[model samples]
Target: MTVALMWEARAVEGRGADLLAWVRQQPLADEPLRRDVLRAPQDRVLVITWWDAPYDADLPELPEPDAELVTRAVHRWRFEALPEH
Candidate 1:
């Protein structure tokens, strides 16, 4: 099975670049099959990591940034990839 973990956060005001840099500097306990970092309007940053594990498996995820750097708590989600038709 394959699992994809998503972590999203919104930076405070004009600190989007700083927040993105911080996320890039973070290291996971284990490397994933693949990873991606994305950004959007409103200073939102999103990271997706794909791993070869069960849906309920315990996987390493990105940690939350400092409170002062973000507008609110981070959002996270996990999904099990389905077969490609």
Candidate 2:
């Protein structure tokens, strides 16, 4: 009964790389995840994360608030990982 989370957030123009670099620096990724969250900025970014655990997956950590990369359009999604199908 593993769960996966999808993290979506908007970044300032040209700040996607910085945002991503910050994400890559989190302790969350240190956990055993199926894959690192996907990141790309099209004027913003739609981050996709996949993980498997005995229970719900924890959301990845965000960078410091001081960075001012937060977007009003931020959102998080959770899903249950299904059996091979």
lDDT of each: 0.97, 0.60
How well does candidate 1 match the true structure in TM-score terms? 0.98
Quote the positional error of residue 16 for candidate 2 in Å.
Answer: 0.9
- Highest TM-score against the true fold, candidate: 1
Q: Could you tell me every candidate's TM-score relative to the true structure? A: 0.98, 0.64
Question: Which RMSD does model 1 reach against the true structure?
Answer: 0.5
Worst 10 residues of 2 by lDDT: 58-67
* Per-candidate count of clashing residue pairs (backbone under 3 Å): 0, 0
What is the TM-score (0 to 1) of candidate 2?
0.64
Model 1: lDDT equals 0.97
Best by lDDT: 1
Candidate 2 residue 9 Cα shift, in angstroms, is: 1.3
